[model samples]
Target chain A: MSIGQETVLEANEARVVYNEDSDNPVEAVRSISLDLRKGEVLALVGPSGCGKTTLFNAIAGLIPLQGGRVSVGGIEVEKASGHVGYMLQKDLLLPWRSVIDNVTLGLEVRGKPKGEAKKIAQELIERYGLGGFEHSKPSGLSGGMRQRVALMRTLAFEPEVILLDEPFSALDFQTRILLQSDVKRIIREEGKSVILITHDIGEAISMANRIVVLTNRPATVKTVHEVPWGDEVTDPVAVRDRPEYQEMFSTIWQELELTNGQQGKTMKGAA
Target chain B: MAMATDIGEAKKQTAAPPAPKRRPRNSTGRLRIMAYQVAVLIAIVAVWQIGLWTGTLKPYVYGTPWGVMQAFAEQIANGTLLRHFWVTGQEVIIGFVIGCSLGSLCGLMLWLSPLWAKILHPYMIALNGVPKIALAPLIIVWFGLGMESKIAIAAIITFIVAFLQAYKGTQEVDQDLIRLMKSLGATQWQTFRKIVMPGSVPWIVSALRLNVGFALIGAVVGEYISAEEGLGYMVYYAGQLYDLDSVWVGIFSLMFMALILEAVVARIEKMLDMEK
Candidate 1:
C-alpha cells in the first residue's frame, strides 16, 4: 500500500497448467499477481489443492509459466536461475552428507572452492545453533534441527529472495512456533526477502508482514492483508501474544471457512 | 526342556521388571542360531566320515573329509595351492576393477544420453539374459588359454551386472532432489557430480558386491574351459585323475576367494557410508 519499501520480487499475472497437452489438463494457478518487498516476509495462505506450491515453484523458476512473468531484482526468472533460494516442505537434506556438507551443497554445486564453502557453511551452522552437529548426518538430527539445517542451507547461498513452501508444516506445533521465530529473526538479520507459502493462518499472521490469501483450485489472489504488528514485536511467538494476531487469524480463518463451505455445497450439489 | 523352562521362569520372576530383557534375549538368540549352524555343518561332515570309515560309501568317489584336509595340507606345503590361488585372485581383482570402472562409466554415459540408453536398452537386456558362463569357450578362443582369457571372461560378466545396476541406480535418484539442485542454478554436470553420483553410491556398491562373485565365476569358468593354471584348472585336473580330495580342496578355495572379495567390497561400502 505504501511506496516507501522496495520491491525485490514481482509476479505479474502468473499462470500454471498441469498436463497441458492432455485432454484432462488441470489449471493449477490462474493469473495470480503479488510482490515480495525488500526485507519483508510475505506469506501465501490457501486451502488444500489451491496451487500455492505451484505458484511458489513458478516464482522459484522450477516450472515455466503458461502466462505472465516472475522476476527477482528486475531479471526475469528461469529454470535453475539461482536468483532465489527455495526451502521445500521436506528438509530435502542429503542423508549421506554431514550437516556442514549438506548446508554447503549449493555453494559446491555453484563451483565455490571447498574451503570457502565450508567456511561459509560453518559460520551459518554456528550462528544458527547447529554448532556441534557439523559432522552428524541428517538421520541423526531431530525434525526441527533438520529443518534448521535446511534453512541454513538456503541462506548459505544468500539469494535476494527465499521461497519457503510450507517449511515448518512437518514439525510439531511447539517446534514450528520456535522455528518460525528463529527463521524470521535469521531472515530479517540477513536482510533477505521471503515468500512463505503456508496453509496455517496463525503462521501467516505471526510471521509475515503481508499475507496473500488464495482461492481453491485454479487459484487466484483472494485478498492481501498487511499484518498490523507493532515494530517491537519481531518474534513470531511474541507476535502471537498480541491481540492483533488473533484478530487477524480469525479474519483469515473466516475467509477460508467460507470457501470450504462453498466447496462442500458444490460437492453435495454434484452428488 | 521342562526343567530348563521352569528354571527360566523362576529367573524371570526373580529378575526386576523393566530390567532390559531384550539385550540378553537377542544375544541368546544369536548364539543359538550360530550354534545350530555349526551343529548342522558338523553333522553333515560326521555322517560323511562315518559312511567312509564303515565302507558304506567309497572314499574314491566322495572323498573322506580327512583326505580332503590332507590334500589341502599337501598342496599348501608344496605352495602349488598358493600359486594357483594367486593367479585366480589376480584375475578376479583385475577383472573386477576393469569391469566395474568401465561398466559404471558406461552406465553413467547412457544415463546422460537418453537416446543412447533407449537404443542400448534392448541389447543390454539381451546380454544380461545370456548366462555369461556360456561365453567361456568364446572368451578362451579370443584371448587365448592364459590368464587373459580368464580376465576377459571375468570382465565381461562383471561389466553386464555392474552396468545394469548402475543404470537403475541413476534412474532411481529422487526427482525432487534433482529439482532442488536445478533451482540452485546447478549445471547438468554439477547436478550429476554433487547429487546423482553420490546418490547412486549405494546402488554402485551393491553392483560391486554382486560383481565380486560374477568376476570369480567368470575366471573359474574360463579356467575350466582352457586355462593351464588357477584353482579351476586344479579342479579340472583333479577330476580327470579322480582325485576327489584335491577337487574338494579347489572348490573350497574358490568359495573362500569369493567370500574374501565380497568382504572387501562390503568394507568399501562401509567406508563410503552407503551401508544402512
Candidate 2:
C-alpha cells in the first residue's frame, strides 16, 4: 500500500444473517474476509442488492455479526465504537442545522466541548472550499455541496477508518466525476484509510488501491484486483486513461456478470 | 490538484436559475381582492340596515348594527367589556401554555417506551372521543366557579389534541436519521434530543395552531357553565337580561380574540420555517 504494512481494519470470515430465528431466514452475507492496510483506499464492488450494505453495517458496528469478527485497529468492531466514521449514499444532513453545525455533529454527539468542536470543524470548512457558507443551511446548498459537508462531517471526528457507502451514486455524471476527484484529493491529504462500497466498476478502479469483487446475496469475495497506478494517481480522469484501468474494468465486469447468472440459477433451484 | 478550479466550475453549473420569482403577486390583483372583501362587508351591512328601516326585523330581537355599536361604546365607556376581555384572555393564555406543555411532554415521553405507548393507545383514543365540553359542568364542580374552572376546562380541551400530535410527530421522524445517529456512536438520549425533537417540530407547530382554538373553546365553555367575568359570561348574562346589542358585542369581541391568537401561531410557524 506504500504507506505501511500495518493493517487498520480486518474482517475475518464475518457473516450476517437476517431473521435468523424466523421460519425462513435469509443469509445476507455468508462470509467476507479482508484486511485494509493503513493509508489505503479499498473498494468493495458488488451487484445490486448483493449484501454490500449488510457488510457495511457489520463493519460500522451498526449491526452485530452473526459469526466471526470485524475489527478496526485490532479492536473488535462491536467494542470499537467511534473508531470508524461512516458516510451514507444520501448526505443525511440535518436540515435544521447550518453547514458548520452539521460538520460538528459527530463531535457534539461524542460530548466534545462546543467551542473546541466548532474550532475543529471551522478548519475543515475553510480548508475545503465551503468557507463563506458556514452559516448556510443544507437546503440552500447544491447536491454536490451537501455531499462535501457530509464528508467534512465524517472527517471532523478524526476516526481511524472511514467507510463510504456509494457516496456518489446520487449525483449526476458531471457532478460525480468532479466530486470523485475532490474526495480523492481530500482523503489523500488527510492520510485516512477508507473502505468504499459501490456497484460501479469504474469508480472502484479509479479510487481504490485494491478492489474486492463480491458475488450476489450471501455475498462472498469473488476476486481482489490491485490497481497498477499508485497513490500518486488521485485524479479519476488520469486513472481512466491508463491501459491498466481499461483492462481491469472488463475483467471485473465479466466476473460480476457470472455472479448474476449464478444467482438466477440458485433462485430457480429454490422455486 | 485543481481543487479550487473544480469547486468554481461546480458552483457555476449547479447554480439553478433562482426559482422564477413568483411575480410579486401584482398590486392590482391584491387591490381587487381587498375591494371585493370590503364590498361583501358593505353589502351585508346595507342589507341589515335596510331590513331594520323597513320594519322587517325588530330592533329588540334582531339588534341593529348601530345599536350593537352603541352597546360597544357603552361597554368601553363603563370599562366592563375591557375587564371581561382581560379575564378571558388570561384564562386562554394560561390554560393553553399549561395544557400544551404537559400534553406534549407526556406524548414525547411515550416515545421512550413502546410498551407504554401500546398500553395507553386505546385509553388515549377513548378519552379524546369523550367530548371535553360535556365535562364543563364537572370541571366547574372540581375547579370551582372562578377563573380556575375556566383555565381547567381550557387545559383539558387542548391537552389531548397536543398529546396526539406530538406523539405522531415522534413516530414520524425519519428512521434513516436515527440510524445515522446510532452509527455516530450516539446514545439513545442524544438521538432523541438532536434528531427526534427537531424533526417533530412541524407536527408540534400544527398542534399549537389547532390547540389554541381548542383552548379558547374550553375557556368559553367553562365560562358558560359558571363565571362572573369573561366574554362567554357576558354573552350569557346579556341574553338572560334580553340585552341583544350587548350579546352581539360580546360575540364580536370573542371572534376578534380568536383571530389575534391565530395570527400569533402562524407567525411562530413562519419563524420555524425560516430557521429550518
Largest TM-score belongs to which candidate? Answer: 2
Clashing pairs in 2: none
Clashes of 1: 0
Candidate 1 per-residue lDDT, tens place, A163-253, comes to: 9999999999899999999998888788888899898898888888889989887999998999876346788878888888888889999
**lDDT for each residue of candidate 2 in B198-218, tens digit (9 for 90 to 100):** 887776777788888888899
Question: In candidate 2, what are the lDDT values of residues A1-271, reduced to their tens digit?
Answer: 3556899999999999999999999999999999999989999998899999989888888888999998898888883267888888899999899999999999999999999999999999999999999999999999999999999999999999999999999999999999999998899889899999998899999999999999888899999999987777889989999998889999999999999899889989999
Q: By TM-score, how accurate is candidate 1? A: 0.87
Candidate 1 chain A weakest ten by summed lDDT: A1-10
B181-259 per-residue lDDT for model 1 (tens digits): 8889888888888777877777787788778888988998888888789999999999999999999999999999988
Candidate 2 regions with alpha-carbon error over 4 angstroms: A268-271, B1-40, B50-62, B127-130, B237-244, B270-276
Spell out the clash pairs found in candidate 1. none
Task: Score every model by TM-score.
Answer: 0.87, 0.88
- Residue A199 of model 2 has an lDDT of 81
Interface RMSD of each: 2.2, 1.7
